[model samples]
Target: MTRIRREVLTLPAAELGPDNPLPALRPLDEVHRIDGRERTDLPADMARQLGHEPLRSLLPARVRDGYGRTRAPRALDALVIENDRLRATVLPGLGGRIVSLVHLPTGRELLYRNPVFQPADFALNGAWYSGGIEWNIGATGHTTLSCEPLHAARVPAPDGGEMLRLWEWERLRDLPFQVDLWLPEGSGFLYAGVRIRNPHERPAPVYWWSNIAVPEDRRVLVPAEEAWHFGYERRLSRVPVPSYDGIDRTYPLNSRYAADYFYEVPDGRRRWIAALDADGHGLVQTSTDVLRGRKLFVWGSGPGGRRWQQWLTAPGTGGYCEIQAGLARTQLEHVPLPAQSEVSWLEAYGPLDTPSTGEWTDVVGAAEQRLAAALPRARVDEAYAAWKPYADTEPGTALAAGSGWGALEVLRTGLELPGTPFPESTLGAAQEPWRQLLRTGVLPEPRPGRPPGPTPVSPPWRDLLETAPATAHTEYHLGVAQWHAGDRAQAVRSWERALRRAPEPWPPLRCLAVADQEAGHHERAAERYADAFRDLCRDGHDDDGTRTAAVAALGRETLEALLRVRRTAQARSVWERLPAAVRLRGRFRLLLAELLLAEGRRAEARAVFDAGFEVADLREGAEDVGRLWNRLTDEPLPARYDFRMRPDTG
Candidate 1:
């Protein structure tokens, strides 16, 4: 028999403080633009889906970069689901990640469970952590709910045992999804059944990837003779599997830089990938055919890559590589899920036996044989069939609660979602005003001295705002909704109207500056940004982490806008106004170096680099440190600061 119980896993972690109170008005610039001209060899269907429905902006959700580098011991809520052969620990508050999967017989841990909880800037919105089996939903990068919570409850499993179900409304795509985890009696494999439902009458583009981290020393094996190699150079090219660039790529440490290898699994093959140790024991992940893609990601044996590995966890912790499964042939593509339809699939993770001491073909062949005998294709298909009936079973005995956004959506749209219930009892302070708006026809006014509530830009919310009474609150919300809909002119007008009666002009003023910047009016945008920063400073705020993060976010943009228009003095003023703690951050330090360079203070800029700082949330392909170092002197960029992803074109 299987049992599910609540527990706590404590680790030294930085508090994921309050979310930054600023709307993400600008488009996400970190999509890592791919070069299409070099990918002519891609299959017709894969290429077609690759260019379809890309993300522009991550509106509605706010930035979650408030976490600091300082860490303290803290206890995190978790759920433990165990049977006779295996045990699995899940963190409901952290995107339902399976933090630990252990085999009882050998006492071996299957996943690379990270020892620390360090939030980095990796998600579509912000703040993603490394390790564990993360269920990424919504977009190409990490899911926005990476460091957020998901509703959890215990439900009846197909074998009459209990399973843990995690559900949430993914805000980016406006879809409801659920993941059910269970370990059948005396079974060695842990099963995860996932379903994403599109309740609206319109089609939605969906992306999902189950990211599993294992020790990098192991050799990974997938059923493929070739792979689509996507390197940091932003180029996607095909190459022979196991061996590429005169070395065996199956060994994670063989490469010299970070890269992705999307295995080209042939049709009718069992969709699976495995990472086994040298002595024939490690983790293996297999899923239904619907989840077709398998990929291997490695932080290769380079200085930049090693630095990233250390930055993600404790210094002494060993590095790990990721073996992922997804819906498309590559992570860049999005599969279309039609309206009123749901995509569900079952996945299993367990131990495998295969020796890495032999040749590549021999090793993979032995692993395939072991997998076939342990959990055959028919068994997987039978599990999926059995799980389908339990997929809609209503959850019982709530174990954890996620955000109230799902409940609010259900209230507004009257959509009856079975199995995953968004009951009104889960609504909180954040959803109060929206609840009022849905009940009445107008949005409520903001409380005095507090920041405005989050702006919902969905069509239904936008329609409600358009018919509401004309107040500063409504006008500002309307402007955000209009901007998301691509109504630039109307958005500007609404912001102007908001300024007329806005007690706090900073919010609307900042928005107007974004609009001006987008329209290429740099001078006007700089002036408005300066004004907004001044207004925000004048209106006193607490010295809490949230306020400091908000101020720092605004200050960074203010300096950038001013610098763009050659308003050097204004940029200096804004930079000086930032709190001492904010100026100490790696990002702000880099910006200060830029400002010094702009002012011809070459020595000061060099000194800033010599001090040695680490950008906690540096993008995957960013060359900021390298580029800045080059501008300062002709000396080779320091190994510590060298994060250039792609080879130099020149």
Candidate 2:
């Protein structure tokens, strides 16, 4: 019979608990799952909303939905199971986190087991820990309950093996997911099967990821040539993997670089990845189907990156890297499960004796011997044949070059799928035949600049706003509709209400500020814009794209209004939060200099204006800055001519 042991552990709370300091809930909207109104895709803009906004709700719901501190210095239990081939340790106290994996034959721990329990403010739920394999379900980021305890059970294996099960009933979303891990007799690898169940009648959002932490020994083999990153803006761009920084990233990285990247595997048959030291000993992770996308998180192993390295690792424990595999594609573009549906996946992990050469073929051969897969080799050929129909389509070709996400397949089939972010300025509805030229062609376009999106028909603006006042998105649309409907006062109230519901609800705040700016209330507009930007810094976590979008939407108008009224100090406060990309513009730089002078930062302002842009060549945007310059110092604007229209128009 298989022998599985459980151990209890006591530990201190993370020195830095969740970054969320608020334990008190405000009166925010609680959008209950209306029986017939199963909300799926929340529009592109709402889909982009994340971080602390979803954590705290004003209405009563699941307590866990409100971000809080993890109980510390408490009793915890860990489960241990081993065979002649290997041993595994799971901390049920920490969401059944697999803290250690050891190869019995070599007697070496393959996983980077953290010396002590340490959590951080690194998850969507606001608390996460480093080390071990984190079974991530639902949308991307850490699982909601990763830092919380999970329900654990021992499945008595009748087949000469031991199985351990860890499961969770997710908060708010009401999704239930379970993972079963087993080590069958005569098998050298550990097997795990995960099932995420959606019992609701309406389709629900779903995302899955397996994040495994490995020793930072600088020797790993991921058979990928290219990888893409959507980053904060969700702009898809690809770069060479392994050699991203001129060095094969397969090895340990140096310096202060920190990034999140997604690698798309073209050869569907190759679904396994391995990491080994010079001594031919390490760990291997493989899956049944093609792991469409893999994510690599690396914090440079040097003095420069030490700050972040320390942030992620506990004291005395060496730095570790995450080798994550996502279902179908990167979690940036999550998909929704059909109503009353469920999905299951399998992963095989075990010891690897990779050759020192690190050749792809050699790794594959090793996996074939030590790995047990549920799928047959014939599946690879079948996938190729199915993909043939998209051979001539733009998405297919772009995918071949490793430049797109899972949505490209939807584009190829002409299906209107939810969850994919709408097209940005760079991706307007591509003109048909020409659009057929790439994977980026199918991004749905956002409602150009804001205007209530045709005023909800069935639910109507009043229904959603009155029924779900805590919903930032609902209020945002209503504000726009109210403005267009000539109820400017109501629009202002609606937007302000949205801001209070969620600290940064940038869209509504930007719209409100715009209204004030247009009304010639420059001072009031500057104050609101500045406050919104400040909230972005305080409560906006992992929201680079949101911050960028907010500033881009209102920075110019806000700063212009402030400068026009000589609210230099207020202008400077807002200016600092603008993204580097937008602040570097000549017109913005000129406004910044005038403001700097107002604050008595004359030297800095003079340098900024002097070196910013030649006034002679600034004919297009010279007027605003020129006027500000004259008002501030009684000086004429730089010499510039406008003999013709702008370059873009020409």
Candidate 3:
């Protein structure tokens, strides 16, 4: 039998005593779970109408319905077994133990369970859902990991007038494990947490963290100047791309990239945190406890066959965000304490509309401020400045040729924009002529008498060619111009050429895919689409706008092509990768249902069709699809016809 070891850390009393500045929670026992209706104290009938149900019964019904049959033993039996195992083999050693943290070798940390409620199952809209796990630390210091019957429950409206029923649950488990499990309520968000308590007479050194999985297109930003170590062998050999897969690992204090920033606290305290997302929208924030001064163990998946680097891309179907808080490993070692000490940790989840650094500073305070202050901005700037000389030199120029121009242009544009925003009139005046020339390839040359403020050039290809090698974007744009000019062959050539010189390959690959698709080279288009998807998925963890846009664009293109080819099966498969809400839309679920019906899978098709029809009144695009659906099934239609056009028009 494998020997089980409980991981324990201790800290001194001076750093985190009872008088510590952080908010305090009542002892663990005071924490309890209450159903929403009960917490709100609604009347009996009102509570029933509100869909209040016991939390423990939530998942069994969902499991039964999902499997479409009643089992000899109730579905909750499995949960009970698992719960028992958690309590027996995992919880007792760690639960309520101040500073004693128990985690599976697989990384699932066993924490405390809510005394008031356990996981439960409920019903909504004839569908089963789960709910009822509320872990409390005290007022203003608790989190409710509930999975209620969203499909039937009426939530309070922003205006306090009416409410809406969003989604029904299927299954839920509030455990510290890394898997691609999603809740219906937080559709695009992955849920994971760690409960830390300092119960010792002194403060205990502890760092709380969550290892989140993300699609590749996302970017990772840290305060480190250089990577602490490369986890995957492949990533060590190559320059990292936004979409490269393999773990691009970082510590609390390395600084190698332009966007990296350190989280510092005054008087030698370090509270480093980082966020990840494909689009700027899905943000994951990770932080370390300043008091503990522990070092964080950060790892990510990279591209290709590397162990550590997994490039996270935005799902071709959807995306998500994550947030975590903990103590740094380094700090844990520096201040090992006696038994019975305690430490606290906190993190927040939501959209990334504002800067994460400021928020971290506000929450973690001095620790965050010091890290931000310690950032070597001057050194970073000096390094970039120093590189400019070599970058402009012949060897540097050659190295950056083709795709370099676009990058330089963008860099220059970024530098210039703040000082002198582009003139609106100039942009507007140049837009049409630029587009016209790109399309027709027939425009008058610059007049000898005229100067060069912003006049359209004749034979724009020459000027464009001059800029293409520097940036893959220029090559991609030129390729688009060629396609617009009805030179499909040239378009393909331009895109391919761009790919050869493109540093990142993504922009050109996207263009190449589109060009191939337009030229009826379906196989080639598919290959390029697949490549783009892979790249996007690998880097989907970055909290950058560009990555998000690229991922979404690639997904849209791939899905649209699959639909056009009447490969509804393929389309549906891709659609399933997206967020449930997105999949619920007409263009996805309804289309897939229609395709299923066309393929003679009537029962399955009707189920999906019915779901879409029920939501037809709620969603905008569903109405037309629903109407067409009625016509197809209720009134007989020809065996084969163009479904893109309406029957009335036909």
Could you say which candidate leads in lDDT? Answer: 1
Tens digits of per-residue lDDT for model 2, 202-232 = 7766667888888777466665667764332
Model 1, span 43-123: residue lDDT tens:
888887787777756788877777767789999999999998899999999999998999999999998989999988788
Query: For candidate 3, lDDT tens digit of each residue in 371-410?
Result: 3443322422332233222211111000000112212222
lDDT for position 491 in model 1: 94
Order of models, best TM-score first:
1, 2, 3
Cα RMSD of all models vs. native, in order, equals 1.7, 17.4, 27.5
lDDT, candidates in the order shown: 0.88, 0.54, 0.30
| Cand. 1 Cα-lDDT | 0.88
List runs of model 1 lying over 4 Å from the truth: 36-41, 543-546
- What is the full ranking by lDDT, best candidate first? 1, 2, 3
Residue 273 CA error for candidate 2 (Å)? 1.4
